[model samples]
Target: MTDNSVVYDDNIMITMRGVSDSVGLPYTVNPLELVDREALVELREGPAGSAGPDGDPAWPWQWRGDVADFSALRALNLTTADARAAWRVATENKIYYWTGLEFIAFDQAFGRTGKPGPANVLSGTAVTGVSGSAASARITGTSPGQNLELTLPRGVSGDVGDPGGPGRIQDAADVLIDDDHSLAQDYILAWDATRGKFVPAPSPRRGGPWAIAKNQFSGGTNLNEPKVLAAITIPGQPTRWRPQVTGQVRVNAANGNGYGTRCDVEVRIGGPTGELVGYGFGYDIQNWDWVLIGPRFDFPPTPTTDFGVVQPNQTITLYVIAKRVKGSASFTVDTTGAQLIVYAEPIR
Candidate 1:
């Protein structure tokens, strides 16, 4: 046999021996040189066909005569093909495959079934039945095989859950006073240390009573001659108390032809011991107009002396006096407007 040369009539008979033995029959060689030795070698060594082990096509296959049904597949001698392999067929815009027994959708077989189908997808805004960003889908059916329907809820509220713990509350003793219990009128509420609770008690007095006395004096007097203006008597009391005295005397001397004239006023308070205790004095320049004199004295409690702290049955006497100083010009004290007042308030 030559390279790229056809096999002669004699060699054809030799090649038919293997085929005839395999089919269990006698074989006759064709008279014409139908196949060359090179072509035969290429057929054995070349790439496989579509249905061959290498899966390369022997020739381009179409939609099997452009038909889609099983009858078309049967007409193309592919219905009883190998069950392990599949064949691609096109129908309109979709691609399908023959899986020996039946034609399976290409997308479904390869799991490339595009987007969710219209049956599996939903549309429009979300209502009560469906809820999602897209309001895509919701399943509703009482029983299997029934048509799915949108079922909205009645907007009913769920049952309440169990209550929580007691928190700050401990027991009935924690409550202090309520509407059922209240304090009486004219009474004050005070905390009772012994009972550890609030109780009603009598109201306390705010302040004690006050005693007042006032007097005044008038007329003219010579130099160095002291004239008594007014005198106030303080009655005795059961309890010890303090006396606060305020006195004022207006004095004026007739315009003296000699230098300037001056007048003086003095105040004194006497206790039961017959001795003058508190003494205060004031001076005024003698003028035609009346001028004020005398100091206001406040005496608080002094335990050591009866003058500041008046004892029971003690008499308090307040006196006001006036005198002329420089010239012999007659000095006069205003009696009506001038005053000497005292207040005797009880001690604590």
Candidate 2:
């Protein structure tokens, strides 16, 4: 017995590269989800009928390891019967193809330049009854196992918020105070629930308006040289202004004051000259001595009522003026332990 089949070299090297059709494919590709896919020619080369010198009237028509291109195959002018009752068709990027009798659509995938991907079933979460500019999104589930990150829009609880006054609050502008109120330095924001806004307001009284200036007054009197503690401008006109000062005041009679040094401390209003104030006294019938004027004499001598209020809308400053009723006395205002407080009638 002789092996006679060595004459035909039918070793066709066909490589399937790129992405395979993923739709309708029992594997992964679904025929329904295909794009840029070349029409697949599922035919395998074999003897169609009687053999000729080139080889059997078969496809790929490789004779002696020499492959025939489409042109060479077309040259053969094979009839339907010659090719096993049918001829297969394929396309790279054509919308239509010629059937035996007429033109018909190729696989829809062939028309696409890029591979078609599965349609995404994107869904966004709409949280009902929540109002804010803050939004977040994440892919819950997608066909073809896709991962997508999305962001959703928010803001809008109701016409009155939880109370039904909510509106489209998309940014900081919607929550902060209105343009009508001007913010001041060291001021804080007060939440106005009614308007859904943060209104600029004064600093907390618990924190004190500010620490009083630690100033020292000496020699005869400080009537000409005064210490300005704080300056505050009224929020609006016709507002009643009240100034206050609280602190530990120390008085000392240096050398030569000789047992009869008396000092009067004056808390004045206005920068250097407005009137809304108070007073205290520091004295000793003896020479140089340290005196905490608060308990020694009537310190903060004037009652809060006597602390007077003047015109508004202007700069009202607290001025400390000290003078000696008799000899020479020196005074130190302890800023570390002192505070200045001012109040206005028309509250903002």
lDDT, candidate 1, at 170: 19
Off by over 4 Å in 1: 1-218, 221-223, 255-260, 271-281, 284-301, 324-330
| TM-score of structure candidate 1 | 0.32
Best by lDDT: 1
Worst 10 residues of 2 by lDDT: 58-67
**What would the TM-scores of all predictions be?**
0.32, 0.30
Name the best candidate (by TM-score).
1
Off by over 4 Å in 2: 1-176, 181-187, 191-198, 206-241, 247-261, 271-278, 290-314, 324-348
Which lDDT tens digits does candidate 2 get at residues 1-348?
999977446543334434433353434342332223333323233334676567575333212222234344355555443432222233233233223343343345334378778887654445533344456656666576655555555544457535645564323674565567667665667787888777776654422244443433222323323444334343433333444454434444454443655655566655545453556666664433333322111233332433355444455545555555675444333333333333443322
Candidate 1, poorest ten consecutive residues by summed lDDT = 38-47
- Clashes in model 1: which pairs? 49-56, 50-56, 217-335
lDDT of 1 by residue, 29-95 (tens): 4333335442221112223346646666553323433347545555666554544334444443334
